[model samples]
Target: MKNFALFLVVCFLWSCNKDDQVETYTYTLGIPETMTKVEWRSQVAVQAPKPIASVGKIYAYQNYIFINEKHKGVHVIDNSDPTAPQVVSYINIPGNEDISIKNDFLYADNAIDLVVFDISNINLIHEVERLEDVFNYYSDYQMPAEVQAADYSNFDADSQVIVGWRVEERTEIVNYNESFFSDNSLATNTVGTGGSLARFQIVNDFLYTVGSFELKTFDISNLSQPNLVNTNTAGWNIETMFHADGFLYLGGSNGMFINSIANPAAPEYVSMFTHWDGCDPVVVDGDYAYLTLRGGNACGQELSTLEVIDISDKSNPTLVAQHALDSPYGLGFKGNDLFVCDGASGLKIYDKTNPLDLQLLHVFSDVQATDVIPLEDRLLMISDAALYQYNYDDQNNIVLLSTFNLN
Candidate 1:
């Protein structure tokens, strides 16, 4: 009887403890009275600059690539293969904007001087000579009736008569006087002036450099020293010059100018293709010319568009297609495709397979793309304070592959 009473007492104490632990606690479900959540956020992915990286834009050679940075020198990339590019060396050049290569020589602009580099070696690039004697090549002014005579235009008779509102057409309606300047003293004169070298080209035995107010020609049969041959006043704000087919093309704030270089010592104005405002960044292949219009500084008008023209007939270039874009600065061609360095939209690709019907193929964003050149089969190099490689995939698509930041 005593053992049974002890067991009952232990069971009663355990049940009481379990009941005390099972008691519920009170709580409230409502908004917090002390604070509120802030719902704002930011979005901007930035990458820090790396050492030994390319600085500005990039130019391509058969075996290597050249990249330009603002204050740093040019970076050379080994491109034995398209997909995998590695840096080889850095060629020190300050204030460089762009580069062009021909016959183992490299040409670059230092804003104040037109520089020529000895690039015979893919491993080392050295500055050989600089010409600061360019004068009267370019300006930011309107083309006079005498100068505009060589440009093609579609202006109505009334438009030409309108004083301030007329779109000064660029193309000349009449054929140039072929016999007028053959015996002129100006054809064989040597004139030197202090001008900016905006664009240059070497065709045949002649070297052409576009200056602030005139197009200057030199005899380059002697490669080491270029002798001034002749100069012709072309246009204002001259942006770029190119030789295609049998003609030489000039880009200006005014429009596109075409001249026959069949006689290099005496190039005659053939025609002009007019854009709404200023046309810049010209690239050409065969019968087609690609250009960008970055609008005007004056308030009355501005143009933001890409223009493709057909120059089969040198004296009457025709506009085939146009596409609107942001501040465009550079143009490049690979096969039948066109690449534009649109200021804000990055690098844009288009199919010029049908020059008359240009189609947008792809775009790589955030590049601030200023210039583009093909590297090989499916890769390209872009410039924007550094050199970048972009690749096209099996699906015929484009993607940013690598970046080399030059700081």
Candidate 2:
């Protein structure tokens, strides 16, 4: 009778313990892929054309189109003939996401370093100089939530570089009070034209860049030798920048910042215009700044809109109008035609003759547009899957010239 009572007591305790525990739930984590710092720094090559696996920013100089392959390198294409662009060469730049060209010199961000290349001979490009430790974007090394803490547990940052991620699903029991974790996946240039999504912009002799929340200036006054001249805290969550009439317009996650580049080498903050939190890329024409706030993906909020801000008074910018958009990404103006690469909703063309009431002209929903460059002769658009060229000469009937496979 004593043994039976002991067994019952043990069973009851076990039941209570199990009832108090939380159930298991499966979630995915991104495991970081790393390499030795030495190897990453020395890995720069210009070789035969390889298929582009990803798109970061698109830049056009003379007749060549340079497309960034996320954290890998850049794919150089001969766009002399927009009807059919060929992937002529690939510049192997580890952790490259932006590029700009001036006087045949191609400037790019290689990890935390600023690397300059002589691309005068498109087929024979070589590294000319490199400025080391100019950026503090360790955020690039930071993996998405939950997984990031795990990243610190497994990786050593002192001697390694994170180039990519390997996703893995895991199941773990959690208490009722424990919150669920989620992963957030985290140019210029030039004398050449950049898509509105470009962070690197070349204004005359100075090259300016916005990363995270800082503005970095590079004095490329000398075509061959570039110098890091200044660094200023410009805005919060800055995404892209535009230069117009000696002023720099910075688009951030929370607002628009205006800085006067009258000094060129160093920028002075002028004013700010706050907006809904989202990922925005800005472009300016005359006195108005056009911003496309995209909400989704890693961009905060679930609202997408096209906002026009009157910057005639740079110090006190106010909203002109806000129009709903499907998922606006990169945008630019070809004459008075405002072309927006609306994700999923395709190419949205508008008559911006009136900024207050942007007259919607067309929405080409056939393509999943992300970023675009309104070149002098044609329009170059990069989607999730391909590079598309269109002849916007006939505003009434914009024609697709060709589509290059980006897969």
Candidate 3:
């Protein structure tokens, strides 16, 4: 009886093992693409202001607010009355993300080209000039399961620029045993300040923009005609750029780089403060730099913290203090008060008069904040679905001004 029971147990184990060893297969999928050309230029026209559907970056110029519509265009709004801000015009720019204004001229990226527009007359805005192929990085597309297992030999880089993407269903066979991993500035004049999430900045007469691996410089000395002067290879995953004094502070996934813009057209590397890999945005005040590093998603690090670095000495930046945060994103400053958008935790206001002992003053926990731009007494906060404006009192109390919905 004991031998019969042992044989039955062995048979059961074999059957279970066989069931778990079923053959696995991989398949190729198709992905849809929106392609454009490097020479493509669109005439700036005044379209009936459309409701905000997507929010990318927000910029304030005088009483006007310019909000980016991701890869679409800029929505010009008259914010003279914060209580009743109205959308004035929509500047149709394809593959657009960032915008900066100087001396009535608006600078924005239209795919591979840097297109400048005359916003002095908002109703009759027109494209003045386009610097072709200044920006080379294109938006990535989703790869279908079928395309993932197939060759990208059909991708044509010569004539078309991929602007949008969608995945389609298809099939191909492949061995499923292996695992796969994928990884992925400006001006001066009366230029409006972008959020800490900005990649474009205008400092003096030069416009600086940081790409995934390079910093492209353009001479905005001639407002209508921006001349591409120099391109410097920055580190990988360069995310945001900020100008303080004569320095260009760059926040990358891996570190914070300080470049001297003493020569506005030619930036020289000053120093770099390294940290764990993550998506980061930086803002500076006085002698200290506030950097927020967030984890999860494609950022690659599991850390969520705010780092304060002393930059009195530009050549060497030292980490002065560190504070653990909850998924912090873009940040900005109003005087000594630091406004941090802590994702789901909402907007956190910190008094950084003393960088070493940072104090939290307030937090609007109800809002899902991602980035902030503090303009004078008003604060502009961007979430996934809305653009919010606020007015702060002398005692640091915030008053809700208005909200523009982006569904």
| RMSD (Å) of each candidate, 1 decimal | 29.5, 10.2, 11.4
lDDT of 3: 0.75
What candidate 3 gets wrong by more than 4 Å, as runs, is: 1-40, 43-45, 139-152, 166-198
Lowest summed lDDT across 10 adjacent residues in model 1 is found at: 2-11
Please give the lDDT score at residue 163 for candidate 2. Answer: 75
Question: lDDT tens digits, residues 1-407, model 1?
Answer: 11110000000111212433332222111111111111100111112223444345556678787666543346677867545667676655433445666777776554334566776876555666666524322111122222211111222221111112122322112213334224221122121111123566778777777754468786766554556788887765566787887677888766788888878798889999877655476888878888987754431136678888888888898988888887776778777678888876788888888888888887867677777766455555455455667665432666666665544
For each candidate, give its TM-score against the true structure. Answer: 0.62, 0.83, 0.83
Considering summed lDDT, which 10 consecutive residues are worst modelled in model 2?
2-11
Evaluate all candidate structures by whole-model CA lDDT and list the values in order: 0.58, 0.79, 0.75
Clashing pairs in 2: 187-199, 187-200, 188-200
Question: Arrange candidates by lDDT, highest first: which order?
Answer: 2, 3, 1
Tens-digit lDDT track of model 2 for 288-340: 89999988655677889999999999899999899999788999997799999
**Between 1 and 3, whose lDDT is larger?**
3
Which regions in candidate 2 have their CA more than 4 angstroms from the true location?
1-33, 145-159, 164-198
Residue range 293-394, candidate 3, lDDT tens digits: 998755767779999999999888999999988889899998888999999999999898899999999989999998998998789888988879999756
Q: Which sections of candidate 1 miss by over 4 Å? A: 1-57, 69-77, 80-99, 108-115, 122-197, 296-300, 375-379, 392-395
